[model samples]
Target: MRIGLLTDGGYPYATGESRLWCDRLVRGLPQHEFDLFALSRSADQEQRGWVRLPDRIGRVRTAPLWAPHEEDTRHPGRTRRPQGRIATGLGRAYGRRDRRRFTAHVTALVESVCAGPEAGPGPGEPDRAADLFTAGLYGLAELAQERGGLHTALRSEATVRIVESACRAPGTGRTVHSATVPDYLAFAAGLERALRPLSLDWYDDDALGAVDLCHAASGGAAALPGLLAKRFFGVPLLVTEHGVPLRAHYLAVPETPLSAPVRALLANFHGLLASEVYRQAALVTPGNTHVRRWQERFGADRDKLRTVYPGMEAERFAAVGEGEDGGGPGTLVWIGRIEPAKDLIALLHAFAEVRRDEPGARLRIFGAPVQGGEGETYLARCRALVAQLFPEEGTDAQAAGDHPVTFEEIGGAEVPDLAQAYAAGGVVVLSSVVEGFPISLVEAMFCGRATVSTDVGAVVEVVGGTGLVVPPRNPRALADACLALLRDPERRARLGAAARARALELFTVEQNLAAFRGIYLDLVGQAPARWTAPPDARHPAGRPRPFATPPEAHVLGDLIREPAVPGAARVPSWAVGAEGVCAGARGAGDGDA
Candidate 1:
């Protein structure tokens, strides 16, 4: 079966958020033909070059998330070489009727975003923004295809005026009311970029339309193309969000550069978009309960959501995890990307508290600052705070030589890799006030070390009663948990063993691949949806492929639409028996792709 693996700033790129797991999934299922659809977030990501893809990856198509617009007419199945960003160019002409249709669609989209839980005006009345948004988005796409592309028109004064009208409409939020003219223009510009996928040549029968399933690596920008694919074609979409996109939007942008009004407006837009994505998706998989709860709260059906844990290669740490003893008795280790969210300050204070009772105890920080990320400043602050911490408690700075704390990076001579670093300490500590699955904690578990982590973002879920979890930002509780494990070597040993057992069972790469493989087969077993046409297609000659949906309503049954649904011959042969092949047990029978 053909799979369109969608990604944003990940996979194929040397440095990306979801690169590892994506590669693992593709490599694990070698029998399936894969098509890579990636969106590059930065020029550096494009310049750094792509990771070597296996032969099974039949095609890789990518575009810049930050570029003005592509001038090249290259089809998406082939690679588009990196080029300079050109300013926004032109748009197709819209007649009087076209203008009215566009206005209603944009207005509904904006108003739905600004509305409350029962999103539209009345109960069961329906916001219909999803329909309007898709219609408007594709309508423009059809126009772009007929009359060259929509670069200049998307940035026109008319587009800004429509957005502003929506913001000033009745029932609009206070935040929308506060947005100035400049804010509206800025947002309109950003919206054009976000909608770039609509103008792409990817939606044809030979590209995204040909794929059996569209599997998005992350939500939001990455999933946008998948959403379009499902819209243009009857393909089923599977969204796997490791970190909830809506929450990330709330956390990523501050109110300084963007006003509260603009931030709120953008958040609402993304929220509405997320709701639509969830509603249309055949299956939504969240990496953990933390993300799953976010999805459910944002209109995802509970049944449609599955918790697929992010998998790691456990065998790398197998040697250390299986051993009898786990490092020094009085050592505490913290390892991961150095960032403010990790809450190193609270950990340092907690370590000070631990030192009050056990002076000989040492803390070893094994990790480096996230390169080119928001960590260099935080890293320096942490190092300074570490030096000042022990001295303020009347402890001799001289006696505490080099501060009783050591901050080091991995891949050094002493610690060649992550496994060796985990092996150098008995107790692994996670003091993060904000986290997502805590990958380092899992690595610690794989290395058979007791963990004391703050209760935040799936920590407790991952621990599963195997490790001590304390409330986030509580230094006393964090210190005490570490103290309890440190004082009792037997308890630490027992917990470490249990943690390793849990990790081995639930968090291995093999298990993750198996779960997704199962989900892919299940999605392929449903009926194809019936097609739907817009209210007006004045110029039918230039119209793109007719969009389709089930005549009644889109239910779970509409997912598979091949041999099982009357049109047996129309079904591609590859989609017929994916269950027995990809779902089968792995062996050394085949070599690496």
Candidate 2:
């Protein structure tokens, strides 16, 4: 099968979210061919280049999602026009009629976004606003497909005017009505970028249209191309979300400098986009139940939702797990990117309490701060808190000294790697206030270390009775859980063993690959065959078929040959029934037959 793997700022890239799992999936499944359609978020990301691809990956097509410069107008894959016929500016891209159509569509879209959920009438009447948004969205996509692209139209002054009008329109939200000219302009630019996938050349028959299935690695912008492919070529879309994009957008809105109105508008757009993606997708695979609930609340059909846990390479931690001795029984380890969401403040406070109870207990924090200044700022704050909490212990912020609390990274002298880091602690702790999938917790599980994590995101689901779970933001509960694990070596060892068993059963790359392999076959089996004979061919074109030809059918020799056995009775091919042949193909022995 030919799979079009759609991704944004990830997969095929050397660094990004969802890269490892995607790489693992592709490598594990060598039977299916893959065509990667990646949307790079920044110039730096693209410059870093892609990871080493497998032999099965047939083609790689990438486009920049970042703001394009003047030179980018004539980027490769853009449809060529006659020299004199080319558009020179935003205004010249459309005629008077096209401009009117664009105005109507953009107005409808913005108006729908501006009007809050309350705009929808009671049950019987349906949500007119939602219908308008969907119509406007697809209408713009169709226009972009017919015209060269919507880049010019979406970024034009007319679009700003449409947004402004929608903001000021009667019955719109109060926040939306407060939108200034600058806000309108900002939103117009953002909208243009968000909808940029509509103008991509990937929809052509030779690109996404040629693939058997469109698998979106994550939702939002990544899945936009898959939506277009499904709309254009009847391709089935499979959307997988490790972290819900809408939830991320909501969390990030306050962090941006944009006005409330602009933020609100963008949020609405993302919410609508997520709904559409969910509605259109043949299947929506959320990484955990936490993500699944978000999808369900956003309009994904429960029947279509499947929870597929992210696959990890358990082999790396195998040595650590199988070792006789676990790490120091009194030590608690915290691993993950140092960010505010991880709530290191709470963890530090909780550790202070732990110190009061058990003076010999040590806390090792092993991770580097994430990309922004925020992480550095949070790390500084945490360090300050640590000093204040353990003033009498003589702490060293960079290394483990006589102090009970130590801040360190994974690659330093003591902790050489991830496995070793987990091996250095008896109890792995996750104090994140917000999380999608607790990857660090899973890693600790693979390392055969008991965990005490805050009950957030998929923590409880991932832990699954193997480890202790505490309420988020509760220093007392967190401290108690850690103490419970630290005080009882028997319980810790038992939980560690159970965690390793669960991790081995549910979270390995082998199980993940098998799940997807089966899903791909099932989806393809249900879908009608897309193959058609050419007009000049011997067979009639567009003849309906029951199912697409399986890849195994192309092999020259018999797929299943019965092994010969001494004194075994050979059944004549004509005498054998269809069920007998099927049973034989399923490895039924000659004696059983």
Candidate 3:
């Protein structure tokens, strides 16, 4: 089957949240063809370039999500229109009718977003605000397709005025009611960027329309193209959210410098968009139950949700897991990106306590800060805290002589690689106060190492009963859990064995690939076959059908005839009855079967 893999700020890129998993998925399932529709987040990311793509990738189409520039919209084989110039033909400048439509749709959209909870529909009743949001969103998309792009209109003074009127509308929330001109302008610009997919040329028959299934790697703007594909061409959409976009937005909005009114408006827009995506999707796959619950809370159908765990390479850790030696018995290892959310401070405190009890015990932190000044600053703080905690031991925290805590990256001579880093310790620790999935914990499990992790996100879910869990931000509990495993080798060995068994059973590249392969077939099988034809043509064009008939249909067609030999056994009565049905199905078209 041909799959349209839609991603935002990820995939094919050298660096992205979804890059590794997406690359794994594409490479693992070489039987299917994938066309990547990526939205680049910045020029820097685009310049960093893409990861080595596999042969199964048919095409890579990218567009920028950054500010408007001369080179932003340039795609190979497509004419490049100047940043503010409206093109002729299908992309012609909006007429008076188009302007009116844009105003009506934008007004409805902003009003719905501004409405308070008390004004929304309740219980099993249809959500009036949600309905308005959906209608206005698709209405604008339709307008963009008909009258070039919404770029100019979305940033026009009329659009800002519409937003202002919506904020002042009756029953609107207090936060939005205080929106000023600057806030309105900010929201308008953001909305335009979010809705830019509607103006993309990828929706035509030569692109998204030809794909058998549109598989969105995540929700929010990433899924916008898939939503449009389903809307315009009857293509089925499958949405996978490793991290729920609405949940991320809620967490990130506070960190931004935007005013309260802009924050609230953007939050509402994302919430409404997420709900619509869930509502229209043929299936929604969340990476874990943590994310599944978020999707459920946001209006995803319970029956449509599936929990697909992120897959990891088990072979890399196979040696460590199977080896007789389980590294230093007194060593505790911490792995993952260094950030405030990881709660390294709590881990350091717990380790300090651990040192008071076990003098020879050592802690090896294996990772660098994430790509930002904040991460660098946090790493510095962690180092300063380590020095203060172990003043008598040594001044340099990087050295492992007397100081118990040593911060190291993966590529050092002693560690060399990720597997070796896990192999260098007896116990792996995760101290994140906020997490979506405990990837580091899973990696530890893959290495057959006993883990002591703070309970957050999917830690308990991923670890099952194999590892010890403690409440986050509790130094005493974290220390106790670590001491329990450190003091008893047999228990640690048992837990490590069990953890490896679980990881092997549930979290591997092979299992992930198999699950998605089946899911793709199942979704396509249930959806009605879509056939495209030219407007002036008398007959529809021939194309490969996906899951059009049962596997038995093909075999049964040849078996329908009478026995050639007189003594040969005749076909069953049931087989004879299916001959006409199978023959008729064979004439329809050849499917992926």
Best by TM-score: 3
Off by over 4 Å in 2: 70-90, 322-326, 395-400, 531-534, 537-593
Worst 10 residues of 2 by lDDT: 584-593
RMSD each, Å: 7.7, 7.7, 5.6
| Candidate 2 per-residue C-alpha lDDT over 1-593 given as tens digits, one digit per residue, 9 for 90 to 100 | 67899999898888878999889888888877789998887766766878898887887887777765333334564543321121223357578876777787888888888986658668688777788888888888877777767878888888888888889989988899999999999999899889888877788767887777899999999999899888887789999999998999999899899999999999988988898899999999999999999999878999998888889999999889845443478989999999999999999999999999999899888898998898899999998898788877664533546568777777877678989999987899999999989899999999888899999999999999999998999999999999998899899899999999999999998888988988887776577656432333323453222224342222111222234876566533323455333432211101111
lDDT, candidates in the order shown: 0.74, 0.81, 0.82
lDDT ranking of the models = 3, 2, 1
Order of the predicted models by TM-score, top scorer first: 3, 2, 1
Q: Which regions of candidate 1 deviate over 4 angstroms?
A: 69-101, 114-123, 128-135, 141-148, 324-327, 372-374, 392-403, 529-593
> What's the lDDT for residue 96 in model 3?
77
Q: Write the per-residue lDDT of candidate 3 for residues 1-593, one digit (tens) a residue.
A: 67899999899888776999999998988767788888877767877889999988987788777754335444644444322222222224557787778888998888888884556676778898898898899998888777677777888889899999899887788888989999999999888888877777787887888777899999999999898999998889999998877888899999999999999999888988999999999999999999999999888999999888989999999879844433579999999999999999999999999999999899989898988899999999999998888888776435534468888888866678999999888999999999998888888999999999998998899999999999999999999999999999899999999999999988898888889988987887787756554522323353324344333333323222456798787653224454345432332323223
lDDT of 2: 0.81
